[model samples]
Target chain A: MSMDFGGLRAVDRLDLMIHRGEIVALIGPNGAGKTTFFNCITGLYTPTEGDIHIHPPGGGSKRINGLKPNRVTELGLARTFQNIRLFQQMTVLENVMIGRHCRLRSGIAGAVFRPPHTVSEERQAAMDSYRILEKIGLESFVNDLAKNLPYGAQRRLEIARALATEPFLLLLDEPAAGMNPHETHELDQLILRLRETENVSILLIEHDMKLVMSLSDRIYVMDYGRKIAEGAPGRIKNDPVVIKAYLGEEYVA
Target chain B: MTPLIEIRKSVLVSIWFMFLTFPIMVIRVNTVENVVEWRWHNMIAIGAGSFLLSFVWRYMIRRKEQGIRRQREGAGPRLSIFQRIGQERRIFLPALTLLAVAVVVFPFLVSMYQVNIMTTAFMYIMLGLGLNIVVGVAGLLDLGYVAFYAVGAYTYALLNHHFGLNFWVCLPIGAALGAGFGILLGFPVLRLRGDYLAIVTLGFGEIIRLVLENWNEFSFGPSGISNIPRPGLFGVAFSLEAHARYIYFIVVALAVFTIFMVNRLQNSRIGRAWLALREDEIACQAMGVDKTRTKLTAFALGATWAGLAGVIFAAKTTFINPASFTIWESINILCIVVLGGMGSITGVVLGALVLVLLPEYLRAFAEYRILTFGVVLVLMMVFRPGGIVSNVRRTYQFEGPDSGDK
Candidate 1:
């Protein structure tokens, strides 16, 4: 699926498919419309041109354009922001718990009265939040305020929050943007583990070519909102257009 | 123990002992003619109370530090549903039960003068809770909440005095009027945020009061409307002759009901939405919260409570005046919400009771009362910015989709 932004063509018509259990990275130069494509897919912007389809686990495809971000999330697609958007004032656990809000059925009456069902649902959500926190090495920080975490931890917390949403497909925008080399190396491993252990599809937008090449199963390169190249990471690494648009032609093999 | 630790422990014990002794001392020393003398006793009691309280406070701080250390060592108490529920229940249920008991028996234990003071306190509680719904939960600063109060009062007064409508009949009319005014106020300021919204709401409140004062043809001007009927129980007046205490009971009932509803709303989806808005409006919008509708609901719900309080206020006083609802009144209610701790129901209740009842309790200090109130509020802000109950915290957990967090 693809998106068009008026005559400027921010996200030009492009076809892409993300299979289950695969990690795909979309990379390009600045103003390459990589993030714009993300915004369109995440429902922050509606595609003026084409249809983006999401296939749920139950064997049905749903058109995702023009839906609200939360509605899109409800259909089993969750995302992390380029800049961390965890609820800062809430605790780490609370931030993750909010992602489970779509699944929880305890209304106002149930919360106040706290009946059997409410208790069980709340119990389940709490357990789920803890498991995710544990997975992200954030179990000890469960009670810490989101804002209190170190920058690297904050980034990890954002991913943990997205994971808590229970999406079949996770969209990550620049997860390693501000990370040091060591942290980025660790994040690469974390992304690989997420795909292998969790068995979820991932669509990533990254500027770090090394990290992208190492982690992605497939790569789609864009320039000025148009897909300039698409192939396996090895093929895309030497593609002339991809190198010219992003890594500079001189660096191409 | 180290000398420092020993001192802290001593201080904590003393403060706890003093808190336990305070009410007993107050009851023993309270006198009709020399209420200001009671203030000195309070000072002594608080001195002793603080000594014990500080020790406990220090101990708790140390305990928290130890807990954090344990967490870093992977030995902290694992997050559990039972434990979380127990913690919340411990904080909420006891306070609730205490308030419930107080409301049930207050009229029987107090004199008529005390009953009147209690009624006024109840009004302030209603106002604080109402404003809390907007400012605390929804994070909307509304300086014009008093306008809704005025609208409700005027609605009841005008309808009752001019058309001979009963108090009960006019109560709903007053609520409807307040809700209408609230929605109208919300529309114009929907795009405004933070301090800008505050200024507009302040102006809106002032505008309402000024209109009520100047529009004599309708509001009867500064003289205000007189002979507004009091509410009756099943058509029976709760007067001095029949059962004056019944009116106090009614006020107590209304206060309790308001507390119940506010607590419920605070825990519901709408309550969560309001808190989400308070934390971050842009993110709330991104999360699909209808900003305009959420804000309007807050205003309307808050106004509805204020209107109900107005009914009680009108009926209790049996008279109405534009002077009753003023900017100062709004400030006082706002102060209660802040002093009690924003988003804390129990905190607001305690704050309202103390702020409203302290003046009546210290009638002899009438000249210095406002000065003391101002000093106390400033000190509270400086020393305890999170209000009286800062230690209370909320935690959340999320499990994976396939395997529930539990």
Candidate 2:
């Protein structure tokens, strides 16, 4: 898919496909348009040229080009922003509960004068959100305001919130940007556990090569808006184009 | 800094205020009487007020910073006074009981005039709480809220004038019409935010008032519909005093209902959606909240309350005019939502009472009401900008997986 803004092309004629439960890392230099690509797929910006489609396991492939961000989420695609666009004033539980919004059916009548079904649905959503929090290991901070969370916990909360959507595909932008090594290690484990247990595909944008190499089943490297290399981590680590554009020559083996 | 420095700074502030007010306060041209009046005593009052006010401002600022500093330093979060009261039902219940007793007896104990004033206060409380849903929780800065109020009022007036419908029958119809108008306003301004949204709503309020003023065929062209029947009790006739007391009870009941509904809504699924929408539009949508639906719902619901209150207003006054539903009415309601505490039902209630009633009790009440309101708002901005009360979220206790919903 190609996305152009005025004279600038943010994501150039590129094609990406994720299997049902594969963990893929999209590694690129700054402004290489990984986040832009995520935005395109998630319907924040419609691709200028190509089509975006999602196939939810048993469902037929449905085109999602130019749909609103919320509709893309409803189509089983969820993403976390590069700068963490959490509802800062809300509690961790409420944040995740919002992720459950598209799945539940409730309107003004259901909200104001909740019937038994609505009540049960709300309770189930909360319980499901709490279980997601437990899986992501943010249950302790469940009641804390999103703004007050420590940097690493906030990142995990974003993932936990995304997980609450029960999406078939998850897009995480620079999820480990501010995390310490220990926290990164934990996140790697969490991502793997998510793939194994939650049965959701993950497309991550990461700068931490070590975490990326360990966590990703495959890596797609990009430079300036075009995909430069697509291969296993070992192959990408030694690619001349990737070395010149992103990873230094000295590290190329 | 030092005590001496603080005093010097306050002196400078007082001097600055005096200079600022010199032209407006100290010098007044009497255009009709043909005299240039110099009121020197006005300068004295201004100087003294600013000097004392400056110290209080400085102290409040320091205290606010200290609270933030403590929070940042990981010094165990300190709950606000309201939050503490909410936590300990012992303090909350009795305070609630006393207020309930006061509301129950206030009309009977007071003169008809005072009861009438209290009824007005109740109307404002309803307006404040309603606007609180839009401007406070949903984070939509709607300036045309009075448009819905106007809709409610006109709904009752016109329906009664034509069909001879009474207040009780018109109440729901008025509210539904208000919600319809709300959606009408909501659809156009769905994409707008902050200042832009405020401007559109402001324009909307003007449009409604203008329509009422010029619609000679329908609205009677601003002379207003008068002699509208008071809300009757199963067609029972009453003395003017009895009607006043009866309307007071109806309003109080309605006000209490609004509070209960608002309180319940603030904790529900849609309430959470509204709060989410208020904080960040993109993030809320990404969480699968339909932005269009959420915005419209907030508009419709908030307008619903204003409509309910507007019906009561027409029945009480036995009159209606475009003048009553001006933009200032919207601003007055907005101020209550803001100064009382956005997103806090209790804060809106407190704000309505303080802003509405305090003026009536003050000396030279009519002349000083606006001035007092301005000074209080300025002080509030400088001091407790979050409002008199901050919203405290209800926490759900965590139990093990085996346990059911508690």
Candidate 3:
């Protein structure tokens, strides 16, 4: 689905489908509207015009055009902020646990009473949070405050938190935004593992072409909010429009 | 499980058990006048208990770490209770429920003076919890929450004194007025954040107070409003002949109700949105949290509680005054939120009770009381900046029915 802004068209008519377990990357230069497209898909901004459909594991597709972010998340779509949006004062584990908030059913009374069921539910959530933390290699930092984690770990913690939402489709806004080369490599591997092992379909916006090309099942290139080119990694890498819009024609060939 | 895990779990269980048992044990120890003297043996026993409790707590934390490690190694263990509860709502419900039970039963068990003190504490608790929602959960620093309290109190006082309206009738009106003012405050200041936001809120609070102080015709200026009607159950007024304890019970009940509702809102989708907003406003907006609505809701909810507290204050004292709802009162409530640990219901309650009661207990110190209070606050901030229970965190679980489990 492509969105058109007033004359400026931030996400110009782009058609894309990311099936379950696929890792898709949206890449472009600054003002490419990659983030805008992610926001549109995740219900952050209502596209000037486009239908964004999210089909959960169960046999149903949610027309998520105008839904609120939390509503979209509730419908099995979760995303990490471009900038880490962790409850900083909270511990790392707590950050991840907040993601499972959508799954918890106990109201105020149940939380206070700690009924047998509440206790069990809490136990399960904690376990799941830890599990996600482990998956992101953040188990060691679970008790540490979110703000105290290293830059790379903080990014991982954000991913862990998003995964905790149990979203069938995970939209990551620059998972490797501030990472070093080693951290980027690790993140690339983590994304692949998340897709292959967890079966989570991912839609990521990344500036790191090496990471994107290596990790994405398919690539969609955008500039000025409009799709410039879309194909396999190799094809997109060599596409004339993609090179001009993103890699710069002079730098490409 | 590894030995570390086993030891940690045991320690956690032990510490929790000790915490559960300490109050019961303390109940048996008789109070001497206003102070409880601890004999050497008692001190020793307390020390031992604390040591054991800490040991258990440490062990549980370590075990949790081990469990996490095992999971990373692809040998994850079964879910634990801590895992299920996660962190966010863990302390909220427990603290609220305990406070609820206490409030419900307090009138029956406590003395008149104690009941009176509890009523005031309950008011502060409500104010603190309300502020916690704005400043703690939403990460919006509001230094002017007491203005809402003042607006509520004055609204009720003016309406009831002039129109002969009952306290009950003015209560909702007071709350509405507070919320109105809250939204008004939210409009201009919502754009500002952090220290700037704080300054605006502070200025707003002072402006309200100044208006209340200057507006002689409406607020009676410095003399304040007096002879306010006390709340009655149905048509039955709480009187000495009947049972003044019932009035105390009513205030306590309101406190419990307020806590319950706040807790509910905090756990609901709104609460998560608040936290998300608190963590990152731009991101929250990016994630589809309507910034305007979330902020206004924070202001409205916070003001609603403050307004309700004002009603309770007016009724409890049978008097309303500008002095009672001052910026200092706002600071005190904020202190409770900070000292109790922001976004922590239990921490706020503990902070309120300690701050409110400590001065009363130190009344004999007279001149030194305020000084001591300041020192204590500084010391607490220095030692535990995150508040008394700062370790509490919000948690999430991903293993739902649709989890891509193998």
The prediction achieving the highest lDDT against the true structure is 2
| List of chain B TM-scores, one per candidate | 0.75, 0.91, 0.73
Best by DockQ: 2
**Tens-digit lDDT string for candidate 1 (B1-406):** 5878877777666666666766655455437775433344674767666776666666776776776688789775444443354468786688658867977777778777877888889888988999989988788998878888988888888888788888778878888887788898999999899999999999999999999999989899999988776777777644573344666777677778888888877765567667777887655544445567778888988887788788778877878888888998899889888888787777788789888988777777878877787777876876567775442434333334454432
Question: Cα deviation in Å at residue B52, candidate 2?
Answer: 5.3
Candidate 3: list runs displaced more than 4 Å: A1-21, A48-63, A105-124, A127-144, A148-153, A177-190, A196-199, A224-226, A240-253, B1-122, B151-225, B230-276, B282-301, B321-332, B335-406
Docking class of 2: medium
The DockQ scores of all candidates, in the order shown, are: 0.22, 0.62, 0.12
**Tens-place lDDT digits, model 1, residues A1-253:** 5566555778778777899998999988888888788888777888887899988888988998998777777787778878778678777877777677667767656856778887777777778878888898888888788888999899998888778778888899899989999999989989888887787899999999899999998999888778889889999987787768766767766
lDDT of 2 by residue, B104-124 (tens): 988888899899989999999
Q: Sort by DockQ, best first: what order?
A: 2, 1, 3
State the TM-score of candidate 3 restricted to chain B.
Answer: 0.73
Query: Which has the better DockQ: candidate 2, or candidate 3?
Result: 2
Sort by lDDT, best first. Answer: 2, 1, 3
